[model samples]
Target: MDELTRAVVQLEENQVIEIVRRELKKGTPVEDIVERCRQGMEAVGEKFSQGEYYLPDLIMAGEIFNSILEVLRPIMAEAKTRKLGKIVLATVKNDIHDIGKNVFKGFAEANGFVVHDLGVDVDPELIVSTIKEEKPEIVGLSCLLTSAFDSIKDTIERIKQAGVRNQVKIIIGGAPVSEELKNWSGADAFTRSAAEGVKICKELLES
Candidate 1:
């Protein structure tokens, strides 16, 4: 990666706001740096899943991500595209885990997709309601608990019942979930990680 991208990677790896700020001041487009940071987080996640890293490291990265985002927000506004399609994302009701979702949100946003994060323990109906109002092209449903997975099923059914299923593509994830659940949920696809999820989302959008 280039120096700007490396700076972004450092921001995600360490969440040092000042480091990214200095890089941005050194002539990197804020967008390039932000996207690079998101990629770095994905790399960290890949390593973590492979047992090369730990949760504490991920937590530290997440902290750095938030810190840099604060400085990059205004710069992002100036770099906005015309429209890249919207994606509405949420954790199902009863699931509070969000590290994965947070990482994926950054990836999606960096890729020119407008992401609406609905936070944790989100009810299906709220997701459905948001879909109706936002009319997003994609709905990203995340769940980290096996018991709380009913929320994912119910949300899809509700969207179908609301007659927007065909209009929106669904992507599901989090631990305790599998391709089987994706098939069962009638979703377009399932990915083991946020990195893969973003890839699937891009494919779905392009296809």
Candidate 2:
């Protein structure tokens, strides 16, 4: 593991920031730095799955990743490339958990996707309205609680009822989300990892 990755895994905010600045000064590619940080986040997720870390730790990892993005966003904007696609993201109703959602947002932005984050505990109506207005090519729903599965299904159903379901592909993500849940919720795909979710979104756009 690299210093930057280790610093992030340790949740050492200051050290991670210092390493990022130092790396930028050394002319390191911003994407490389971001990848290392992402690897760290992946490690944190693995730890959480093993019960070595908890919700607070996961939240801390997201905050640290956001801080890294803050440091890189200006440079990223200066070197802006054509956007890959548009995505409307939300944490479903009755579920306020946003760590996964925020992480996915960060990765999506870094990979050239315009993500309209609808924030946590989002109403299905709001999501449907956003889809109508944003006309995003993809919709991403996030939920950490198993109980929120209904909210995911409801949101998708609402989107279908609103007649926009055919216009956009839907992807759901969270600790408990799976192929079964994706099928049950009527989503096109599902992921537990933010990185994988971004890849899936890219595939959705291409296909």
Candidate topping TM-score: 2
Query: Please, what's the RMSD in Å of model 1?
Result: 3.4
Q: On residues 58-89, what C-alpha lDDT tens digit does candidate 2 reach at each position?
A: 88998998899899888777765889999999
**Model 1 segments beyond 4 Å from truth?**
1-15, 29-60
What is candidate 1's CA lDDT for residue 105? 77
Q: How high is each candidate's TM-score?
A: 0.79, 0.92
lDDT of 1 by residue, 19-81 (tens): 677777887765566666667776667777899878787777777776666677666656646
RMSD of 2: 1.6
Distance (Å) between predicted and true CA of 190, model 1? 1.4
Query: Candidates' lDDT values, in order?
Result: 0.77, 0.91
